[model samples]
Target: MKVHIHVSLKSGVLDPQGRAIHHALEGLGFAGVNDVRAGRLIELDVDDSVTDAQLDEMCRKLLANMVIENYRIEKVGEKENA
Candidate 1:
């Protein structure tokens, strides 16, 4: 089984890195970008025995910082997961 994890900062939390990127884009003449948020993607390969609950647990335990980040799980094709 192939699982995809997207981890990102929660709203209202400070994101200095994202703000820096937004500023850099404006410096490079990129306009109309109101905001920017940075996040992470994690891909996992596992046996069919892995359940959605287990995947969520993995996110909570290590993949994402539960205090300020949220995570979403998705299933992807074998080729994409690879």
Candidate 2:
């Protein structure tokens, strides 16, 4: 099975990288960007036996820092994962 993990900062947390990008866009006079937020995407190819509970545990334990970051787990179909 293919698992896609999207990790991002929770609201109210400061994102330095996002701020930098916003600044850079303003510098370039792009002006349309009101705000910016950055996140990470991780695609994993796991065995069919891997369960949802186990995948969520993996995120909570090692993939994301639950204190500041939130993660979403998406199961991709084989056609898409391929």
The candidate that achieves the highest lDDT relative to the unseen native structure: 2
lDDT of 2 at 31: 72
**lDDT of each residue in 1-82, candidate 2, tens digit only:** 8889999999999999999999999999897898999989999999999999999999999999999999999999688935
Error of 1 at 67 (Å): 0.7
Instruction: At residue 36, give the lDDT of candidate 1.
Output: 98
Residue-by-residue lDDT tens digits, candidate 1, 25-53: 99999989999999999988889998889
Q: What is the lDDT of every predicted structure here? A: 0.92, 0.93
Best by TM-score: 1
In terms of TM-score, how similar is model 2 to the real structure? 0.90
Structure candidate 2, residue pairs in collision? none
Candidate 1 similarity to native, TM-score: 0.91
